[model samples]
Target: MKVLVTVKRVPDPETTIRVKSDGSGIETDNIKYVINPFDEIALEEALRIKEKLGAGEVVLVSIGDSVVTEQLRTGLAMGADRAILVGCDQDLDSLAVARILAKIVEDEGPQLVLMGKQAIDDDANQAGQMLAALLGWPQATFASEVVLSDDQQAVKVTREVDGGLETIGFALPGIITSDLRLNEPRYASLPGIMKARKKEIKEVAAADLDADMSPRLTINSLEPPTQKEAGKKVETVEELIGLLHDEAKVI
Candidate 1:
């Protein structure tokens, strides 16, 4: 089994986010970058699957500039066999990203492609589905658990849906978008980090994939959310009801 795990480099969730002065994008200066947490879960799942099989490869792929190599090396340290950096520094929407991934998928011919359900930065949650569509493969999104069938021809995926869990069986050579509960990602040890440093990271230009890199959406501007006003205290339930009915317009 050959598994491809896609990862994303994102601003550290714990770090404070500030908008650029020109309303272009977030202020990246002095901000820390890490692998998307959900994507880390995906990489962990792929590593576990490879370990279970005892004879397979787990390849990590990501799209970004050279800084993204940091996250890719982290994934490698976590046990990915190799890493590929799709050198795309320009802003790419979900569709363009999907197209690039689809091209890589076609070239690599992996039995499974594992990635996060959504990138936290954009929260688009569209790439895996679009890649599946382009590949004409079955998809299991928001997967909390994935188990390979006894025959090794299909995967039983447990998904986290709106109401509850749903299980679906998908044949090999499909795509899976992992959810938060999929698995706890393992940390890279010192020895693992050293080994990862020795591993090769191949870089390919986004245009080399031959996918259309055209931007479908353009961001006009970005602004921070308005600050909330302080709440007022009400002396009586009737007063609260009156406020809700009139000022708040709930009623």
Candidate 2:
């Protein structure tokens, strides 16, 4: 029943994002950061699973700059027994990120790993899959519901698909990517916050993980989409039809 929950720190959803002046990336200077909303759901799911089992530990893992500790602390306050900071400060693709986590998995053997279906910033749902593939473990993506066997040897996961939900069962040592419908996340209480400060957090360097940073993808640049002006409204249906046939070219 041991669980490892992965989290990420991203700019607060309420914050307005400005593209960098140099066109490299977004300007994050002095911007407030918060736990990724999707990862919050994953943490909630892992907490629930641990609480249900009432016997196993829940470890929260995050790979980012030193600022990511805030996000990890939030998870610790929510009920994670411990935290692991991979401490990869710079930007990394999903593959490298997955490699770092997989190294942590090798060091601390956990039966289950849970993560967000995708990061809000990149919306790239590749980390969990990459980790699972690298570890050669079964993976269930976009999971909404999870049903574990009596002995906790296997898991039946329900995931949302194009039209309906699909259920798949896999053995232990599996990875699952969570969706928004998983569960509601809770804010840490004062007592919980104090307890989090005392919780054990093991910091490891990128070298310790032996993770390669060679990126398979590159970000050319980011720019806003083209803006369109409002079109004049035609009062009569005939006029609208004429406009559609001419300027609009719908006809």
For model 2, give the 10-residue run with minimal summed lDDT: 222-231
How far does residue 141 in candidate 1 sit from its true spot (Å)?
0.6
Best by lDDT: 1
Stretches of candidate 2 off by over 4 Å are 228-251
Clash count list over all predictions: 0, 0
TM-score for each model: 0.92, 0.91
Give the candidate number with the greatest TM-score: 1
Q: Supply the global lDDT for candidate 2.
A: 0.89
The stretch of ten residues in a row with the least summed lDDT in candidate 1 is 47-56
Instruction: Give the clashing pairs for model 1.
Output: none
Q: Candidate 1 has what TM-score?
A: 0.92
